[model samples]
Target chain A: MAKIRPVGDRVVVKPAAKEEVTKSGIVIPDTAKEKPQEGTVVAVGSGRLLDNGERAALEVREGDRVLFAKYSGTEFKLDGEEYLVLKESDILAVLS
Target chain B: MAKIRPVGDRVVVKPAAKEEVTKSGIVIPDTAKEKPQEGTVVAVGSGRLLDNGERAALEVREGDRVLFAKYSGTEFKLDGEEYLVLKESDILAVLS
Candidate 1:
């Protein structure tokens, strides 16, 4: 498997599976599907460079489930698996 | 004037001015204005709540110039001046 280590405050995430059928029995089309906002953190960057030359640590860690903004992050395919690279701030909340 | 003190990791930014003409001397209309990617940090939240129940300090500060992603943050007008409420993560970089 190819390894992908993020740089700076970037985080690698595996998004949750897309829902085929809605609760209302509506089959959403692919083009109409909304962007997934939840994912699992797979990898994290060392830290972001602060103005004072300090490295600010990332807020989320690997294996943590997080909720992010709708349009956040850049998507990539690695080893046939989809992943997202986003900043820690793009993650809205961490699930308990 | 109304005060807008951000909460958590939210920040208030004043965007850079829009350009009426392009470099090639082409006039651009207001409706064709692209979203501003740079701004000045006006106010910031105390800190973000960490998973360990601690507060992680914000990276940016007041009066700092920053670059942010387009389509990020909520926009509002305070005292007739436009401002943006964004998470620290939305801000991509700080200019020295």
Candidate 2:
């Protein structure tokens, strides 16, 4: 992977793989797959600057399994792999 | 309006009014209106608790003009007026 570091409150995520088959045993093609909301955190920004000029600490860290908003974030490609640059707030939950 | 107190990073917002007339003096119908992405903050939730049990303060406050994601938040009516309950993270920017 390329050495890309996200700035304040941004995160780099690798989307989870799509399910190959449906619950009904129907083979779902890539084009028919819904955008996956689950991912593993790859990188995290330092923190967001607060109104008082303090750096607000990020809640999530590297390697966390997180669920994010479906349409959130900007898409980019790094070293032939796809990644998303999203605000830490876009993450809905962290899976245990 | 109803007295609502959002919990844990949630917020109440009043959407900006839609434009009624076009620059050409033609009235734009309500049916053709787009969802407003700008609004004024009405109420704010207490800060979200962090992993270490610290409450992180919210970035916005009541009466702040904000821009939010178009499809974000849960919509409901309060005393015949509409309001949205959104996570503080869903707010994109605070306008000056």
Candidate 3:
């Protein structure tokens, strides 16, 4: 239960760890791995301003797991905890 | 010259290398490093479908270097080269 309040249309995400090992039982190195597809939404901010300048309501609430594309966020760490701040639009799907 | 054509509203970006040596004169390890900022626009797809169902024209053309948030894309490597496909909306700003 990390308290990370994202700013603007940002949402703080804790990326899930890679759990699958290769057929040879080789754990993938961090450098060779891709961006995590799934994340737990720790906190969500008020949605981004629409082109008309009105702040839209956010679609996903906090604690909802979501699917987002890689390369959609500005990566950062808070107190040694890795997280991503992405625009709500970047989130493709919400995991039930 | 690598050829990478993104699909949908996706744009393929070849991330810029981290080149700055720290004050410690040490190159940061990849595992400890963050996502790349600058990128060369290798290819761009037709814009995403708008709410109206029409394809929006992309704001960025191919070959336009741009800045994007780290968590904004789905990362992939093509033929050993790293690239990211992101929705145009995920791009934070265009770098001149």
* Clashing residue pairs for model 2: none
**Which number leads on TM-score?**
2
Candidate 3 segments whose C-alpha is farther than 4 A from its true place:
A1-96, B1-3, B20-36
Off by over 4 Å in 2: A20-36, B1-46, B49-96
Q: How many Å off is the CA of A96 in candidate 3?
A: 34
Per-prediction TM-score:
0.46, 0.47, 0.42
How many pairs of residues collide in model 3? Answer: 14
Question: If ranked by TM-score, best first, what sequence of candidates would result?
Answer: 2, 1, 3
> Candidate 2: lDDT of A11?
91
Q: How close to the true structure is residue B1 of candidate 3, measured as C-alpha lDDT? A: 29
Q: For model 2, what is the alpha-carbon lDDT of residue A33?
A: 22
On DockQ, the stronger of 1 and 2 is 2
Better of 1 and 3 by TM-score: 1
- Could you tell which candidate, 1 or 2, scores higher by lDDT? 2
Which lDDT tens digits does candidate 1 get at residues A1-96? Answer: 115456469787887765612322333345645543767898877697665545788989898877776577665544456666687888987876
Quick one: ranking by DockQ, best first? 3, 2, 1
Report, for candidate 1, the interface RMSD.
13.2
Give one digit per residue, the lDDT tens place, for model 2 in A1-96.
249889998999997766611221222223422322667789989787766667767777788776566678999988788899999877754544
Residue B7 lDDT in model 2? 48
Summarize candidate 1's per-residue lDDT along B32-59 as a digit string, tens digits: 2232265788999987776666676787
lDDT by residue for model 3 (B1-96), tens: 234334347677777675522322434346744543667777776566444444677898777867676666666544456666677777776766
